[model samples]
Target: MKALVELANKAREVSGVRIYKRNVEAVLSAVLKSGDFWEIVDMSSLPVPAASGIVKVLIDEGILFIDDEENIKLTQKGFDFVRELGIETFEDHSCKACEGRGIPFYANIELYREFLQLTKDRPKAIRDYDQGSVTPETTISRVLFMDSRGDLRNKDIIVLGAEDDLTGLAIALTRKAKSVLVIDIDKRLIDFDNQIFKELGIDNARAMVWDLRNPLPEDILGNFDVFVSDPPETLPAFRAFIGRGIATLREEGGVGYFGLTLRDSSVFRWRDFQISLTSEFGVAITDIVQNFNHYITWDYHSETKAAELAPVKREPKTIWYKSAWYRIEALPGFKRWNEPISDDVFYLDEEGSTT
Candidate 1:
């Protein structure tokens, strides 16, 4: 498929988004699986920007087209090409009960109801921070999952590095931990969490405004029993968030939770990333739940490259962003990093599109 590789390369240049021949193949297969633009976006397992770029290039090659109903369609030639490539769409076997997160915490009815009400006016995610909030159900599930995994329930200390979804708020509401500390670059989130803590007299919880790209504050370092974050998937960003989380651990056996996504990282990239987490930081990966954390589209999504590069002009009517949640435990003699990351490439990377 040298010809297809060249086409994906051409599309990459035109769109200034990253994609591989596999992405081109994925676009065509996504179209075959579903005709709707948004559904194809979800099916491709690639960000809208990269998927859009590949789809446009395929259309130019007469491999794909928009039907009269505005649905994505493959030409006869496209079908033959797919068959030659041995690409086939299959049924989704992920659990429908918990959306494949494997944790049905939503069944806990009361926590969902309480968290939904508390976060009704939390904060709108801003593009400036590359921010998007997870659903209230996801937040509650995260907390409950922690409890199930023996990380919560009177856990003396917990930390969240760079939070906007207010998982810290949900943790505080549970009253299961003695203290919860939230650190983020955004003062807006810190103020919101702090305000909620004060109003409810949640003395065990507090928020701080500190960019993790800089050195982590000394007092909190090596002081937490657990850490949770949903940082950007870029390597530097991961180190900035997860590395700081590691530094906060009081000792070995301290656990951490973070999110990674296929949209922004290839499985090969994930391999190297997991290597860094385990080797460089001396932590053991405990769990990786695919599509565990679902994200709501930001209001500014229309202003993103994903919208700009989409082959279709239709707006999305569904939440199409998700990430795998990772749980790591500090191994014996775990390394700690409190060093400043002066590099500015903390958020955006070639493989990362939606941000």
Candidate 2:
């Protein structure tokens, strides 16, 4: 038991990624519950790399071992360690039907099919922009959910930060919103979205390129009823995407939809961000749905740190990356900052593995 705590402390000191004692406890509990490598990571908030690093640490120290089937299993020392830690069993607490997403994946079944077909030839996600698109189900569900919350219908919406998921296209297809304006740094995505708008005669929607790292254009300030984005989680990225989103709102009661992932963020980081938003921006967090956004594994995943560091060394057979959906509303007297965001680590953080 003392050794396990010491190992976690050492990992915190040495691993480039954040490693709390809870991370060690989570991996150990996940191992007890499932032998499959992915199941172990999925059972926790950890990204694949973070989970793998903990498992590898334990394996090297003889607390865990790979079984004959190439599955991860605890050794005698591992069993003893878990017993001493008083974690005799592990149980998954997420909703079984929605897979803990808090909403049915097929909430908007018809739109999903159309959006899927509409985006079949869309631009591939490029690392130059740190792009990774969400599943079609997620995109439609997000729009529908916003409408349910009275934020979508007839509202002029701006999709800033990143449009790689084609959320702007999905929003335009609904014809529920008055207008959709998409702004991103990636020209290919902007071109792809504009072409879709033209072919379908979607006069209500338009896409353009604008790097979010700089201040937004003066002409576009305070020009929308709502905003949506799936942005990078670094503090500066949050300011660029979320701060700018709040500023775009023409008046109070305007809503914003965005996704945040645990893969690149820890609870401590999340707490700091929440404090910043509520205290400085004067917004209310109306909703947070866990694992609501599922990312279809990208083509370049095998070359990423997650793949290289995984102890099992196998390809993912199913969707693995996910994010939480957050809905924020601009309350009366809400504050907004339109200044440029400057941070060298805007795209990557110590807890980050996917970017």
Candidate 3:
């Protein structure tokens, strides 16, 4: 009885795999459908206490045996026992966000070191901002604003992801835009923006709480003359936005001032991911800039340092650290062709690896 319970527990972990009473009618129904068999596990990986309990229970019940190869497999009687209980197995779950790619979160995780270094002595820089964080993309936006081409006396503009310097863009653009629409995920931050705009007499800007992860509403798409965002650097999040942003732009060929960071070591791998976006979506790369001296900072705790240190000058790193900025234009047939002469591409393809 103890062994029976233990076996049932394992099946429950896998989807479509469960232990239930076998009614003759249901058993017949199951027979017509696909079924999963047993799963193998490394005994060494399991906790000693749990493994001992399971092994003892199975051995006492005479349903498990170790073969000549020293691997455990269920016996005929064990299979029969499980079948009587209507036990089933199933395939592992795949992440819909990553499309079964295991490293869906790696891009953000790789930025962890940069975040640490940025906030090492300057905690306030991140905290002063609404999202309490400063990303490489935000820094890039600041850099672009310093080098923007056109006048903004009455331009129509939209700013997405008002977490860091993007918020500043919204506020700055509102001063000149005929109408400024700001979309952000945090309602509190949106409210804060509204209050600040009112206090500053920057009433041209309107704020709405929005999530970039969700599908952009039809009413909002293709409505802005200029769409701006410091989109998430993570690939899935980035992919989702590029397509949405391209659809949101006006056909007169509006500018999209977007920024993102590639890991110091994962530049080639990142370019590969970026190429996937351009191929999948019709976004063209305008200018790719590298900020080797400035690091992307975060604000999980303090903000003063984040705000102060952000503008202050910094020394460049010797190696192993970089903040890259990309200026992308939303246009049809945008292609970023990797140079065949690049040794990085050659090494990646030949070595069959990713950082």
Candidate 4:
């Protein structure tokens, strides 16, 4: 999972201390094996106990944590510290700056550290880019809950997808909500969520793996104040969630946000989808934010592993993200199907045409 690798790389980057090779190996091995806790044991298999003792030193220094069960847990502070190491240039662990083997390897420690802090303490899932598609709706849902604003605090928010959508939000909203109800289709994801909740001591959030297509149980009706989500973009499930989300809202104060990652083929389709929402649910476009698609070129690429590494060559990649924000408000006037042209989306003509 790209997100997991990113998280692990983040942990190492921020640690501030130059980890001995054995300790580094142990910590990474533990992080990959233990999903939530960095707990790695089997002291008998590791290099001498003196090397293991280094982990304790790291723990004492707050770089790592050993829990009651001897599981290693990285503190937010520790996690953040390691992640502070900037984007590193991979060169087979050879000192890039000094070309020496004995010294702490010089790499992009600071950048890595910041990225880790950005992702830490949030519910995040990683996947290969090709494995799943992210819709604008999904991205919007993520931004609504995770963005710097405190809009959802103390509000009852219901999420449509549990695994990727609300994992981070649940952790965040616990500080702000009276409660969060998450519904999903994956039982295993729910189990992972519970573990995270337990680790963070977040008590106001509960998750259940349930498909969004089926009719919700009676107990779930009219229970949420804000219904926000990025449902599976192509499925009827997305529409179903929208209908049910509005039904669950308390009244005129209810709010909903959707994420839809528009693909090359779906851009026109998305416009049609928007119109459908307006006609069917009286939802209006409230906010739209566009992100300049940017790529992160690191010091190392995948092919460089083991076969004599080199200083990473950086390249730029660009991707575009457009987010539309809407609210459930009564239509005030005649519905004009014409989209208001924004500079970010298109170039408009004096004749009122968009390019």
Highest TM-score model number: 2
Residue 135's C-alpha lDDT in candidate 4?
Answer: 30
Candidate 4 ranges beyond 4 A from true positions:
1-150, 166-174, 292-355
Q: TM-scores of the models, in the given order? A: 0.91, 0.92, 0.46, 0.45
Residue range 130-158, candidate 3, lDDT tens digits: 23244433343342342354523456677
User: Per-residue error at 152 for model 3, in Å?
Assistant: 4.6
List model 2 lDDT by residue over 1-355, tens digit each. Answer: 4565677766565455667788888888888987777667767778655787788788877888998777899989889888988875568678777667666657777888888888889888777777888887778778878778887788999999668888898989888889999999999989998998899999999999999989988877888899998888788888889999999989888888899988777777788878877999989998888888888888877767666667876667777688899999889998877998776888877676676
In model 2, state the lDDT of residue 11. 58
How far does residue 98 in candidate 4 sit from its true spot (Å)? 35
Instruction: Please write out the lDDT profile of model 1 over residues 1-355, one tens digit for every residue.
Output: 3477898898788667667788777777777778777678677777656777777878888888898777888889888888888888735789888888888867677878887887778779998888988877788788888988998877755555547878888888888897898888789889988998999999999998887788887898899889998878788888888888898999999999888888766666688888898889999998998888888878988887666666776777787788888999998999998788876767777667666
Candidate numbers, best TM-score first, in rank order:
2, 1, 3, 4
lDDT of 4 by residue, 3-48 (tens): 3343334434443222234444444445434422211322112211
Q: Which ten residues in a row have the lowest lDDT in candidate 1?
A: 154-163
Cα lDDT listed for each candidate? 0.81, 0.82, 0.43, 0.42
Put the candidates in lDDT order, highest first. Answer: 2, 1, 3, 4
Would you give me the overall lDDT of model 3?
0.43
Give the total clashing residue pairs for model 1.
0
